[model samples]
Target: MTTRQNSSADQESAAVVILGAGPAGLTLGNLLHAHGIDCVVLERSDRAALGARARAGFLAANTVRTLERHGLADGLRRHGRPHGVCEFRTDGGRFRLDYGSLGRRELHTVYPQQDLVADLLTHYLDAGGRISFGTEALAVHDADGVRPVVAARDAHGRPARWQARYVAGCDGRHGAARRSLPPTALRHQCDHGVSWLGLLAEAPPSLDAVGYATHRSGFAGHMARTPEVTRYYLQCERGTPADAWTDEQVWDRLDLRMRAADHGPLRRGRILRRTVVDLSSDVVEPLRHGSLLLAGDAASLISPSAAKGANLAVLEAELLAEALVGDLAHGDATALERYSRRCLAHIWRAQEFSRWMIRLLHAAPGTDGESFFHESLRRSRLDSLRTSRAHQDWFAENYVGV
Candidate 1:
């Protein structure tokens, strides 16, 4: 936890104090509200910031069902696009997989995370759910004891304490919830030693299917965000600034890596945003720490390679909401005790798939011989995935299941 602000006369209270107002927090808030449980969400960002903070866009089949089941997917059902095919370009050639027909026969709902968050937020507020916007949660005190106290600072810079029976940390990895964990708590992480310059362009998508291009230079990817906007990714140096390359340079590099000459050219437009994302994954063990429970990115940070971060966040939020409901509304604590183990199972599975995706997309970081061998292995893996129905089935199931 960071520096704590002493409690003042303006003390707040809730049955559960949720930190961070992302997918997990807002989803949990809505579920708890429907269940008649008193919970409040504390968010450091304003509502406008949340409505504009774009992230992952691929929502798994399970995620859509979960949101719809809770009466919170009207926006998603109305605007989300169905996507299932992915084209992989390699040294030899390119192959497209119609994953919607394989494995569990599930397809991804391509809805921008910000739009989903906006929908969740709107539904939450409309239902009279309580949330403290622009309120920064500094630390959680007495989480090991009954009734934890969350120290926070409001928009006016006033110190406030929220007392709660339980605390849900939907905040990201660096948030106070992860900081407040005991030193003995276990946090496992893997650095893939690669980075991608994530790009958002104000142009229509260049391809109908999702594109994954593996080149001698690096990996380049293309995904459609909307009818008028597209998302692109270009592998870059580890510490390179997002804006180090001009728009033209970025487009050229993308063209080179994506082999636009052989296939087709990308539609160029104004670059809206550039973000550097390091490929890495981390998991916090025993998600329950006394009265404090971790959820979403706070419990696990999965690389965006497989677009699993937001989906995992939504899944974990549903699980956590159920557990919290069981404990708060009823006298049952069985679900609460089993939360960590169950969620970790799903988290680890997603991590394994993400690692596979990283290896399939990026060459290993090493000298000439090592890199060649690694690239060869990656190609072999892709070849197997392209030709083997069994391999494709596995990929499709894992790709859209979680």
Candidate 2:
């Protein structure tokens, strides 16, 4: 590798240059490498920082099967636990749904996302994968041409370039891949007018199943991340600061909304982290721009209402790898063009389900005429989900299938 500064006029070439080292980029790297394709992954973060990013941990069944098929499930299978039940708490009462046995007869694999990233990183490195950990992609140029080029800055602030036959833009929503798109690309966005005070508690899970509590004050949720760590969410005003509430206040509100007094007291612990997430979703139409393609959050950003972001990323990566492999290895360009369409279909379906979940979980903001109408509908929907087997089956299918 040359360390000289040539104003990026000099460049290195690969058959495919992937930006980002998350699930989408890493999975694509492994598949392409296995087929003897020349590729490299450029990630902005160093290895240690990248591995410490705590993220969504629920993996859909299809995501699990995809990893298993590619010899990538060794760590997940060895350590992940099967989860299939959900407990709902509402003013009407409480109910539990054994979703695993309902629709597709599948369950999610409960594996912390940080651990999964670490595992994928290890697998790729041990297989002689080429990766630049501290490389930051600044922009992509000439994506519509035969060879796309990525402008980048290294850890030492040195300018460099990577020219490739194709570029996989899996970095993220704010990464260079999205920034480099042409003006003709379309971006659609929506804000659900709600926010969540997301919390990470260093305490054992109070219950054995995923819990959704709908209370008059607000919505609260409980999910188990590990034996010692739990994830919780509380509905808050859109502009509330993450630190506005003290630990005692957070716990008291959680207990109130969750009706812990009626059922059982919650296990309290130190709050390790706090994040305020405004509920929003967005999609970029036509995920491909000539030889530069998009995946993961780069293609679409979904609210974590249904926990579909990571699963969708894995699915998109598999589709993209197959398409690229067919074109580069077998001399067929048909699948390359079809890749965007294939991924968009799944993206829309997942988006629909995610929107449904958002509506189901949160109520109308204020007590107005329209608010009552919307809240009534929400309650009716919940009732149907609780009593109607058909509705339950549908929920189970979408919840775990994605």
Candidate 3:
């Protein structure tokens, strides 16, 4: 609903045009707005529809610090659940990784993605930022500079094109932003056979903090939103369909794999929603194609095993805003050119950690490996992590991104 004037020009223009209104786009837009930069966000979904999307509940210490730097941490800290330790359960027993012991921060928090989105949306809108809903990008032209044009349609179905000094494609994996980039220059991907059946159940979280349970049957984890709501994940066949599962069937499977003796009882409630997705990793080089730059999932993705999705996206948005604003203020492109490189440094490290974590927990199906093999691998890794101060230091640095 916000408008800007374009004098002596038939087309609308701004300092930047961002596609998609997800976390990355909204965060970037807010940062730009704070710096007095003009930009418009075009989203395919209206505000109500955005709440229907999936959630990544974990937020890292660095991410919280970044929000604090932006003066936006009060609301998040107030609503999110903070925990100092993460419980890792296996057939042998459960071990805890205290974030306070491992890193400088006391604990990470779990804030529902919907709540975070609502917060960012509120902050952005309150400041006169525009989010054009029910708009889809048809094409992007001239990525190499002189600005880029986004061809889109409004909610009422009007075709339109807007040009900007730069365009940020925060449109996600399938959006035109990623598709518009030339593949030959920036194709990097890693695929894992694992997939997860994600469920948002109405039941209360079984634990005080995040619990990652690894059992002989499969891998499952518990994440919390509030005292009464929990998010659960269970490993499944890559293409398992939710329709194939009745509520009772789903709960039965979850109850068997996720519940631990330490955790009292598995309480079931109304099944809010469910979906399945393959675990994969990808990063497009440079994150820039002409005037169009990618951020968030569009630029890269990490496995949920790493618990990096929301944190990384928020980090990327903050870095992008700083880079763009710094460049504009000083007439230097250093920040812009270095953005992808800087992000990838952290991105790849998380990818490595996620793969390691998954391997430690999930056994390949039909593997005829001996019990000794599993025990040896688990003990060796854990022992190394515990004894090697340098290695633990590395993990601590990566965990908090210091």
Error of 3 at 128 (Å): 0.8
Give per-residue CA lDDT, model 1, range 1-402, as digits (tens): 111222346887888889999999999999988998888899999999999998888899999999999999999899999999999988888899999999999999999999999999999999999888989999999899987998999999998889888999999998889988987789999999999999999999998889999988899999989889899999998999998999999999988887899988899999999999998899999899999999999999999999998998989999998998898778789999999999999999999999999999997776799788987888899999999999999999999988
Candidate 3 runs further than 4 Å off: 1-10, 259-263, 368-379, 382-397, 400-402
Q: List the residue pairs that clash in candidate 2.
A: none
lDDT of 2 by residue, 364-391 (tens): 7788999999999999999999999999
lDDT of 2 at 24: 89
- Give the per-residue lDDT of model 3 (tens digit) for 1-402: 122446234367677888988888988999988888888888989999897675887778888888888866767888887766667666656666665576454467777777787788888999999778898987788877676788888788888788887888898888888878875557689888788888889998877756777777788878887788888888888778965788887777777776544555677887798878688888888787777888888888778876777787888898888888877656778888888888888777777887877776676556556756865777677667656776666565565552
Comparing 1 with 3 on TM-score, the higher-scoring candidate is 1
Model 1 weakest lDDT span, ten residues long: 1-10
lDDT of each: 0.91, 0.91, 0.77
Question: What's the TM for model 3?
Answer: 0.91
Candidate ordering by TM-score (highest first): 1, 2, 3
TM-score for each prediction? Answer: 0.97, 0.97, 0.91
Off by over 4 Å in 1: 1-8
